[model samples]
Target chain A: MSVKIEVGAGGIPHNRILIYGLVGSLVLIYLTYLNTYFQTEYFAFFGGLAAVAALIWGTDTIKHLCSYGLGTGVPSAGMIALGSGVIAALFGATTGIFAPIVTIVIAAIIGAVAGIMANHVVRMDIPVMIVSLIELAIVGAMTVLGLAAMACGTFEFLGMITGTVSFLGFTVQTYETSVIGGSIIAVIFMLGAIAIQHSFNACLGPGEQQDRTLMLAAECGFLSMIPVAIISFAFIGTYAALVALVISIVGWFYTYRKYIVLSKRDAYAWLDAKPILEPKGGA
Target chain B: MEEIVFGIGITALAGALATVAGAAEDTESDIGSQGDPNSQVQLAPQMGYIHRIFNKAVAGEPPAYGLWVALGAGLAWAFMAMQINPILAIVLGSALAVFVQGVYATTAYLGRTASLAKFGQPVYIDILKSMTTVTMAHAFVAIFTTVAMCHLIISALGHPFPLPLLGLVWGIALGAAGSATGNPFYGKERQYQEQKFGAGVPISASGNIVRYAEAGQRNSLDNGFFSAKLGGPASGICFGLIVFFELWRTVVFEELNIWGPIVVGVVVILIFAIIDRYIEVWARKNFGPYTAPEEASS
Candidate 1:
């Protein structure tokens, strides 16, 4: 189907945005880990924010790679990214060896190999395949780790494993927390997948622009935070839950407003002009 | 201007991070003053706002209704609260959500495109036809590989990788492999049609060359089963060998390093790749060229 929208002229290069997104996500994730380790009750709110940043980064990566037209649908690309990401994240978390670094490195390596296979072996013929896949993998790993950390309030090896087990409803034979916290990772993983994939899938067209797509990304990111906030309410304290709610609201409002402005600016001539043709006599 | 917007976003994020960090530090000092965790306030009202905003944003859009999203979230939470197996809850809940949304989006897209076709816009029916067939085949391969990976991880290694993680790993690996393999296999079968825009024309026009095209004649069920049949055993054996080697070295030889397993894994993958190459060649030679009944009669 033909897309009606027009691509915008020059704007910030996607690579630059991607770089900033990656740096920002990594910093936020590290800070979240620190905060969760140092301060327990307030980890949820900060960690949730970190997850939002990761979502933004991941969505931007999707927008970048998908613009090249992956022969395997956009959703498929997203699933691959998340799939590699979750595995790497679990391995790192479970193995107790520099979890974040390991996760990022492994995901990147796997993604790169997969990209090469797609290009040479499968012969998909997408030029930016390798770099894009690597970026997608790294960002996807960050997204999963960030969200999982937020859910469990820490990314430490023992805490993450125990959190995961608890979330799975398995008893440690010695319980610590009253509520199951690890199950929230499943929620975050699914929501993060949707947020990253939906922005580009929904906004794609001739008129697809970075600004509008980013706005949609922001919206999706905020929407995904709702479940995180609810989970925080049950596990974390009231203050953390309230903070999540507030951040989501403020973020949504800011992004939605920007979307309206960009949409208006990008509006077609027919959007404002009156219809010229009247209904036929048959009507 | 784009740089400026990105800069602003970064700044805003930094500011928020600082605020949260400060608050966390303060909360740490005042932990004794905090209220009971069980007496925490409900999140329904805030969640309701999120639902409303999401609904408004996705209004009239197929597959992403607020109700379904809310229901999915609720089911996940409820399942967890009830102490249901976390993996089962997530899989079922996510599956339900995705299915509901997929149906809605597909229906809407098809309905709108069909209407547009009446107005003279080309509706590529073959695109949809191929998608269904391809997705079914890929799903089978992916599921089989996942099961194989899970068995290898759990039964052999004594490490119980969670179902969710296993699902993601095998799902991605098999999905990518299928896309890589299926594209070339099918690309060889059909001739590419020129189109003005949007990827390529997905039409199935007659081509003069028909060598090895019979592969396309197989039904999706047959194709799916064939892929699973080849892929399942290959994955199982590869993983089994890797795990067995690792176990042998770690348990019997008292070697704790992972290099043995890594090397074994690589060797297994190489072996599988070679076997796959042979299978492809055999299939191409045996399937023969496609000949339409009409073409043969003419």
Candidate 2:
């Protein structure tokens, strides 16, 4: 009961592994499909490996410290899956280089809640399940966007569509007038998000302050990505990575501010938000 | 080369094993919750509260930093290998320069070279004492990685095996091995604030973030970054050069199979071991010297 909870924030073994494997596989497969469809051959080994390492770090840090409970695994898995989704989407973006800003921002938000949840949110099923399902949808959306990008060598709603390197690498015969692809992706994501959210709550259970914090952070993570996806368009040249990074930072700060406020507002406010290693009294 | 690998493997395995053993050694009854390590206390109110923000920021910094260090050490090893020198000189100098000094090297490089490098100071662990050493290490890794990456690209393109490129690859890989072996503890949010911000942030730090989170309590100010810091990057960088050039010999002069990376790997490991041993001696000599005098007086 007195064991320490850790928080570089990546745990929930079963679901997280599933989510990671799914996202990784999906991206790989989608890229493969696009490559085959367009007759190109490029490999993003570094990208894939980097994502895995990042995901592993998150899971190892967040989950290993988790104590036992009825369905605590939900949030654990949910948070990680959500994180994986964010990372995968960022990776899937044609402007993947700028993805970290979103990832970082979301990561902090998730991390805070994960930290708080590490204390409370014992029977976490609904949110965890919902986040897990969202990961798949996120990956799917990203894949669609990736496929579109692969098709036209441009991002969603961007004015100009270009061609893949044709004979050199993964070929997507994208020329101008491929606006439809990205929109379709948007539609799919919107439709899918609801189902995913439903499952998240299904996996999650009763109201604990810790649960609130974790859920809030996870929500912040998703919200963080919206800007990431939006700002990625303007990501250019040297400012590319930094811009993304800044966005992510903002997301994290936003999550923190929201949580701090939320925690303060709660009647059961434990101003001393230390982890309740004793499992039951956490949140 | 074989020796270096053996060294790192032995060190990492031993270190890992020792860590596990030490944890196992701690019984439920033997210690406290870090209050005294012998007495159980409630979630001590003394813990830091401004905890999550700093924690998140610091936690966020590492992957980028770690990746960069790993890659930088590799790249430096490769670049230094370009110059042939005393086996000792090359090995020791580069290892120190790359693995230990790599954070410094990257800080210097980024500060000088890239636009973002200018931001190097604030975010990067100061080789001297700043929050961004981890960041600096990672940046170096990235630079080295790009160099190695060029070779990989060329190799995939199937021109002649650019002999120089392998150096970059081996250098970065070995550097990671070196850095990982030297300072292996992963940090938490509380640690990040205490270590990184020094007195800059208003966040309070917890003795242990294991449980009971707090913020802005303002206990002691501990910006100390060197937990068990030593200079082994030099050894790592050198080993990378050695193994790389050694492999280059086979690549250019004769035909070898996968022995290139393997041999390089071995040398890298051995170099780390030797470096670790030397560092232990150095630390003992410097830090322990005072202890001996104090003990004598007692």
Off by over 4 Å in 2: A1-283, B1-179, B184-298
Residue-by-residue lDDT tens digits, candidate 2, A159-251: 223322233554444531122311222221221222122122221212223333343423333332332232222222224324434544565
Q: Tell me how much of the true interface, by contacts, candidate 1 captures.
A: 0.01
Give fnat, all candidates: 0.01, 0.00
Interface RMSD of each: 14.3, 19.0
- Top candidate on TM-score is 1
Q: For residues B1-298, could you state the per-residue lDDT of candidate 2 as single tens digits? A: 6544443443343233223212211110011111121111111212321121111111111122222222332223322322323233223322332332222222222211111111111111122232234433333333333333333323332324232233333333433343333322212223343333222223343343333225533211121122212222332333334434443434433334555646656766788689989998998787554222223220
B1-298, model 1: which lDDT tens digit per residue? 5533443443334333222222221121111101111001011111111000001112111112222333244344434544666456544444444443433232222322222221222223333344333432322222332333333343344444433334344333332333333222222322221222122322222221111124432222332343244433333333334334433333432243556546655676688789989998897788754433343211
- TM-score of every prediction relative to native: 0.50, 0.34
* C-alpha lDDT score of every prediction, in listed order: 0.46, 0.31
TM-scores for chain A over all candidates: 0.81, 0.29
Candidates' chain B TM-scores in the order shown? 0.36, 0.30
Give the range where candidate 1 chain A is weakest over 10 consecutive residues by summed lDDT: A269-278
Residue lDDT tens for model 1, A206-271 = 545666666666666665665565555545456766776687668766765675565444433112
